[model samples]
Target: MGANAAAFASLLRGATNLSQCRWILEQLINSRYAGDIFLGNLALQMFGKLHGIGDARALFHRMAQTGRNLFSWSIMISALCRDGHHREALGCYHAMNLEGGIEADMVILSTVIGVCSALQNLCEGRKLHDRVAGCGLESDTVVHNALVSMYVKCGCLDDARAVFDATPTREKDAVSWNVMMAAYSSRGKFQQALEIFNDCLLHSVQGPDAVSFVTAISACCGLKDVKQARALEELSCSHGFLETSVAVQNSLINLYGKCASLSEARLVFDRIASKTALSVRAAVMEVMLRREEKFCHRFVIAFMLPSILMWCLGLVF
Candidate 1:
């Protein structure tokens, strides 16, 4: 019976027919293994993926009658968070704590911390940080990464930096480096972000990925440093980052525009296969406006006006 329930849940995962999924789940609920914990959690995951959070919440309340396990609690919390119910997710976390038998694991801790981050609940986040330490789960790299992200989100870069510094060498993955760099970049600390990018090069066991390059290029845009931006662009290409990442290409265009290199910006812009038309257009126009008056007028008449007219026509008709 349990096997049948799991199989049904697995089938529901790939199921596109919402009505059929409902029918199948109803069949399972009427079966002998309806109380199976694994089936209940798997059903929650399927429902969340299908945007049936209302149904998932209903199922959660029913399951809570018999008492939910830790995994069940985590899934509900995660589902609530993914659906943008941050306060509800936090409330669920507290409820899980007060419910008593089940302890918080890394996944739950990470989810609640993320909720706190999104809500910017610093006092609650700090208390949770102490709870994490007391639970001896602070050494978990996943939880550590979450704490770094949470602190950064709450605008406590000092606290974020402290967490990053404490991360063991073995556990400092690319995300850890990326999050730290992002924290600095988000605050307009471009030089500090670049410095961290450089540190990633020197220290991280795993090399920078597309996200890393994009963040660093964004920092270059903020600095408006043409020389360093060009160097970074070259470095990204050499690492093959530009070959697959459209975001890196877009950032290259913005970086060159910010540095007043219209020609170079156009070169990068032309290379993007799937361009975001309006944003690219805006960047091009900003660079054109900075050029000598004669060139600017000629370029605007020859290029910008037509593109704008075309975009407006597409929207209208």
Candidate 2:
């Protein structure tokens, strides 16, 4: 019966029919589970993917009645996020604090961090982060990466940096390195990001991704590292990064312009593939053209952002 439940859950994963997944979960509940913890957790995962949070929650509660386990708790909390029930999920985390005599493992903490990010509850995420550290699960790389990403996405670059700094040197994978670069570049700290780029070059084991390159170029734009930015732009092409992505060229345009090289920016813009690219290039270009005229007239502190404000300028001028 337990094997059947797991196989049914596996089958449910491939089916997009939420109703069918819920039905299978119901079938599992109607029949005696006989303390089959694995099948219970598997059912929880299937319902989560199908967005069947109500049924998943019910099953999780049933599991608790039958000498509940950690897997059941994590699964239910994760499924609860389908409708943005982050706060409820956090409550679940606290409720199960002593009942099961189990603290949140990596999976549980990751789900809570994700919830915290959705709620923009950075303070809560930090408190949980401290818990992860105090509990000695800080050595877990997956949790470390998740914490960094959650902090970065929530616009708490400082917290992201603190997490990055605390990451053990041995566990710093490419994802961890990229997260650190992103945390710095996100807040316009391009100089520090560039130095990280140099550090990445020194590490023979680490190979940065296109996302990493984009972050480095973004840092260049902030620091007006036109020369180094230009070098990276050329290197991207020479290394055959396929220049297929509009984001890559867009970064080039922004970096060149920030380096005070409008002409080079134009060259980069002209080379962009017209297909599969969003209209943001046109929007950015409009703003860049306006900045050309106002470079001597106004402080224009918010160059790229000023493009939206230029729509009002267009109506006036």
- Please name the candidate that would achieve the greatest TM-score relative to the true structure: 1
For 1-317, candidate 1 gives per-residue lDDT tens digits of 45676688777777676576677678768987677777777777777777778988988998876457988998999999889999999999999889898899889998899899999999999998999999888868889999999999898999999988887766778898899999999899999999988888878888788899989998888999999988998888898877667778778877887788877776666565555655456455656667545544644555567778998999999
Backbone collisions counted per model? 0, 1
Off by over 4 Å in 2: 1-7, 32-35, 120-123, 150-159, 242-244, 260-262, 266-276, 279-317
Global lDDT scores for all candidate models: 0.82, 0.72
Pick the lDDT winner: 1
Reference-based TM-score of each model: 0.83, 0.75
Candidate 2: tens digits of C-alpha lDDT, residues 1-317: 55776676576567576777777666766766635677677767887877878877877877776656787787778778766788898888888885757767888987788788788788888898889888887757888888888888889787787887777767677777777887787777767888777777566265666776777887887788677977888866865552665666677766776777866765665565552223245335534664665432222333334665777899999
